[model samples]
Target: MPKKKKITPKQETALRCLQQNFDKRAELAPSSDDVHATISKSSPVDIDVDADELEKNIATLSINNGNTRIRYILCLDIEATFDGDKSFSHETHEVIELPCILADIKEGKIIDEFHTFVKPSLHPQLTNECIALTGITQVDVDNAPTFREAIQLLDGFMKKHSDKLHPPPQIGSPPPNGWPNLGPRNYVWVTDGHADIERFLCLRSCRINRVRLPAYISGGYIDMKLLFKTHFKERGFRRLPDMLAKWGLSFEGREHSGLQDARQVARIMLFMVQMEAVQLKCNRSIVMEMNLSFAARQL
Candidate 1:
């Protein structure tokens, strides 16, 4: 019998994804209706289209290199308090935990970190399921800042970092399946999945507080789930644990801790950069014009 040739890990995963026909949309649980609706706002865009010679005065679209290198990256993860244990209700869900990291893209390591627990105004007492699933305790929320205060703290961090970092490039479109290079700093939001972005894009946080949406998230965010899809063309996204396992990685911190999740995301990003697979950037962002009631909010 002939011995089979060895295949690379990326190639192997591709084979598995192709064989399994993973459903990218299926990553969300049925109770994820809020996330589903929030994510639905951004539609997939066509970078280029075939045109007929007969069509007149059509602008030519150039092909992009699909290279989306950036100088810096900001990773964010938010864990909210929900009414139900399993399902997060959009009407009642509030941002109870937010963890973020600022990292040097070239260095592939975190430079600073910010994390805080937020007190939910509407649903002050976290449901039993939320505590068990997220490993947050009543004391955690009891001593935490209000949602507004937490946002202020995050804004302070970003402001300090902005002064220290380089300016961003001119706002421009990214390659298909890539994030918009908003500035020279190459700042883009990163998350393990779409659910996090949904929470912001939906503007639920702003509406609950009756304030304008924060400018921090206005820059746009990268969904690792979509980024992975771009590379592997997989049907569905893998759970964070499964994704880590594939790369021989173990969860470094607690499962539901926002800080841990943010750190893990940074590590994953660093791995991608080190392996030369970090081309993907964010492709969608919150259409805040529709959500912010034309009121401008500072970062």
Candidate 2:
């Protein structure tokens, strides 16, 4: 057997953070401004620790000066198909499947999942290759909702969960929800990779006749694959199964199916959270880094 690589001190610290659940993760994030108070409640120091030292400790690992608020993460995935053409351009292909699961970052579980098959507008007929490749039957396409209808369903699903996360003064008719509230909301949308989003926008753009994609669609989503790549110092884009396997996780469910793929993305993410991989959100998605070697060089 090959020798295992030795874990470093930073990695050990990261591991400790995971063992403690996400409390440490929360300490470093922007939302927990009163981190010292919170941690004091969880694990009290026996000796009289100086207030300055406690503040110093919190400041060292903290992501910011403590301002922004992070709440939830929306893990999602998409599936698309192409006519038998080998050189199919994503520019031409449409979204045939879309699925998403809203995961509670603190609670550590999926609150809800949404998926819908989208009937193609241009091609309309699935090539034999498409059928075999995705295991999506022609009947699935024929009876499924249109791409526009899928968007409506997605909007509805987001509204449902958004209200659950932050309940309204009163629930009536879904009331156009608070997604547009430009302040740093505690929730973010995540995907296995970026191409899925690109394809989704491609199809949606065509339907909207070049109108701007919704802000929720454009800036709202994070490509989780990028997060993993940054964490492990990985180069180049990879398929979901390959990324999962690299992290010693087997695929959770059906590979190509959108919902299953989304679920797998969610599970792997939870695994990362468990491993104490730190996520810092400055503006876009949280950038998780493993700087074990870099920190060692500093010492």
Candidate 3:
């Protein structure tokens, strides 16, 4: 087995601050220059907590913070193909394969991730082009879990993992001053269409039969493609990658890879929330602030 590296205190501190900011962003708390400055200037505390313990602590802190409301936005992305013939039947534009990724976003940060490959039960074979493009083979699909099973596993994972951490309050909860916190938090789903979500919902409904997820998960999915088109027309940006570059943040790694793409989008969302808060000079605890180790990237 390979040696596991240890995390330093500096990295832990920075991660804590990141998580705090994410929570605050979820609640639309005003940006705090004081928090930013404090994080920037503070030296890392030399503590000896294990990385796993540190992460649990941070999650606890995020759940307990009452200063800013927080929410967990679960996002999924799917893979599909475009037929050369648009005038053909609807089935002609069918999806050859699919992969799903789930990201738990609090405030503006992605705090957790889940991913899985799905075999289309109805479509066992892939076109040669599809196989070449996605690198998914007919054997791969045949051996993979069915769409319904895949989503059920994902749902179970989401509930299990998310429940392990304390969840932030529902968005729009009354502030300490008793005022209704306002603003839409955009649960941006980067996908080809609503198929993934539809499948997820259908699977979830089948499992619970009647119990429904909260409205946050139930309604208003932000489609990146639509957002891109609108941005181009109104702001002259053509794509997500273009938008991120313009904002001075780069989406690293391959574009179409499911988990990588979800992680990239999650980061972009967090950055946007911070920028928005900073621009407005809002001082709310949009992020849970803490410090841990430099070595544990997960922490």
Q: Highest TM-score: give the candidate number.
A: 1
lDDT of 1 at 21: 27
Order the candidates by TM-score, highest first — what do you get?
1, 2, 3
Q: Give the local distance difference test score of model 2.
A: 0.51
Off by over 4 Å in 3: 1-68, 81-108, 162-217, 225-237, 278-299
lDDT of 2 by residue, 175-205 (tens): 2332223333455566776556554544332
What TM-score does structure 3 among the candidates reach?
0.49
Better of 1 and 2 by lDDT: 1
Q: Write the per-residue lDDT of candidate 3 for residues 171-275, one digit (tens) a residue.
A: 211223321222333222344334434433323222222222221232234444444344335444344466565444455556665555655555544443444
lDDT against the true structure, per candidate, is 0.55, 0.51, 0.38
User: What are the per-residue Cα lDDT tens digits for candidate 1 across 120-222?
Assistant: 8878888888898788889888877766666655555565577554442211112333333233234667787766656642346656765434434544456
